[model samples]
Target: QVTFSHCVPTIVQMLLNAKAAQGTDFKGWKITIGGSALTRGLYDQAKARGMNLIAAYGMSETCPLISGAHINDELLKADEDTRSTFHLKAGVPVVLVDAAIQAADGSFLPADGSSQGELVLRAPWLTQGYYNEPEKSEELWADGWLHTGDVAVIDEMANIEIRDRIKDVIKTGGEWLSSLTLEGLISRHEAVRDVAVVGVPDERWGERPFALVVLGEGRELSAAELQAFLEPAVAEGHINKWAIPQQIAVVSEIPKTSVGKLDKKRIRSEIARWQKEGSAEQTSLS
Candidate 1:
């Protein structure tokens, strides 16, 4: 039997082929996906093969493995709806971890499925302090709990759905928009291979989201098509219509930092340079 703990689409395909060659005597599979975000298409393919796949969520601070979907339980089964929700959620906290969502004023809110707050945790295996940095450690645990820096909402079932990073959430005209949610929705388009949404300066809205997109090979998508796809989301009030990007830049690939995460800072710098050069060229033409 072969099981995968964390894998991308490419690796999952390889495992599926390998399992088929092993014959009917091979035992069932148990797979867990816990890194980055898994698309709905990948989840459906794995579930169809009777491969027991569960979505797990955690971070490095808690020695990872905070919570995971139960493989055989009906309540935790991965279905179309569950898979969609699971992809957005961080799952319920593990048995040993004490997790809560708190407001800016440090008051605990009810897990009524609509309130949003900062995720804070206290667990046995969590790190105690930052090595050789007492000041940083003190700041990290100011309220006697490890501040996760993630904004999330907990439903009645205690499932913790991560909305966005506190810093990454876009505040436009007094409304907050989730960049992660927007990115996931945009990436579902066939022409889009990968996408990222970042908050950029706007005089009217305070801040607005700008899309950084990577298209599939030989696929060309216009800014209008991207905007059209987002129209329904805006109409439903999931995002402000005005929050949509004024420009969508299609690139060969999004640059990532050494840690393999999207480098938004670098993207912002590039945008600034491009604007400056464009202004200089227009001045010379005039």
Candidate 2:
């Protein structure tokens, strides 16, 4: 009986599974996925199960509607795969909004599409600053652009592909690894129902990617199995070897925020505590 809804991928997954188990299907329900990056695995799954999954992106500061997926008439009759690719992106800039990526060197990258940088934006309707937080406000509007903290590549056609958050990018073995991209790739695994990837402190590499995965019902997923599955992609140059997660933890559930986004801040804190405890234990053993 539902026609339209907006929810994160996890909620959509749970809802679709529940309907399937009850011998029913969604009535071509339209779902707009946000709060976190939407993986193609989730998009395909929802489509296969009779749901239209649209990818959208925004933050609380921008009135929350900066971009969304919208296929033009020409692309409407195109193949499902082609259309799905567009639908899986963070989306183009909305009206009256100007989106640009700021390179690490502080240069404005071109829209030719190869560059990946921090997404900075400007819009008339965007909130100028946080309430009563002068220091944070100045930081937010530094250099005359609203820093989104999201790293993305914006194509010439204005197609915006969000790769990762600046703080969440994994720097291991002296190369950058995108946690969001890793999560998307790992989610393609049959046994993976949900996953969260984070950068953990490492003395050798500074920071290494650590993943927490939730397995599908009756699915037995092992670290080796998952790593082996990802090896082919690495060999294919689809991802760097260092991009493969250093550690993968299979957990019963991943924590979520009140608004249903991945609680990565909490995860980082927990990982730090566990690492400290492990170090103490090793010292005792020695």
Candidate 3:
């Protein structure tokens, strides 16, 4: 029998959910998940099916190996909830690399788990330039740190929790909200298999979170139900009350980029086109 195999979390998940195996044949299979944030929902689903999967975080610039959650005695002794919290993080930096979160003003933030900032890193093995693009290369290495552009919070234990991209973070009513956080919460619904949240412009609030969700096979859900599902997160203080998305649309699938990241730019453009067409229809009816 093959002792191990590896692939993206998405592919592993799809294989595990296949009807032929009845979810039992994949036991003890080893997988390395990367290229995107592996949400708790997918993690739990894979675990329940008896697959051994791990979360890793990095980029092409760093040669793609930064942090990985390796289960140890303490992690193995922890409860499911505790273990999931640790598993969901990007884990500590690997050997020879330095990672830290820095405030917008270039000040370093504490790794107490709540202070949000952009993740900056320095490593000898990291890529130097962008193929003759000196300006972009300079921007990438501004202040001698490789600005990853990823917004994250680091716990006292040094586990990195990626909150969202700096450009994707939603600012509405003078508050900054993490689209990644919202997407994670919404994916907890039984009917939701995947989700993507993007910030869209608003006249009154400056910007709002818009969600596109993919439902599980044979599952049905309503936008209001999805909104209701997130209401408790607001009360629990995981998110601001107003941070609950005003727009939750059920879609067959969320779009991804060439490297399998959520394509927010295209999504925003699509939403703008829809809003324009909707306005034209309303004007015609009037």
- Selected candidate, larger lDDT, 1 vs 3: 3
Question: What C-alpha lDDT do the candidate models reach, one value each?
Answer: 0.69, 0.83, 0.81
* Colliding pairs, model 2: none
Candidate with top lDDT is 2
Rate residue 276 of model 1 by lDDT.
72
lDDT of each residue in 1-286, candidate 2, tens digit only: 8889998887887875674555567757898888889987787778777889999999998888899987888779999878888898878888999999898788999987768899999999888998899998987886879999898989877988898888888887787778898888898898888888999888999888888888888899778899999998898787987778758777777878887778889878876776777641111111
Ranking by TM-score, best first?
3, 2, 1
Sum up the clashes in candidate 2: 0
Q: List candidate 1 stretches off by more than 4 Å.
A: 7-31, 35-54, 70-79, 279-286
C-alpha positional error of residue 246 in candidate 1 after TM-score superposition, expressed in Å: 2.6
Q: In model 3, what is the error at residue 167, expressed in angstroms?
A: 1.8
Better of 1 and 2 by lDDT: 2
Residues 24-140, model 3: lDDT tens digits: 666776677777777877887777877766777898899978887766788899988888877777888888888899999999999999999999999999988899799989988
| Residue 198, candidate 3: C-alpha displacement in angstroms | 0.5
TM-scores for all predictions: 0.80, 0.91, 0.92
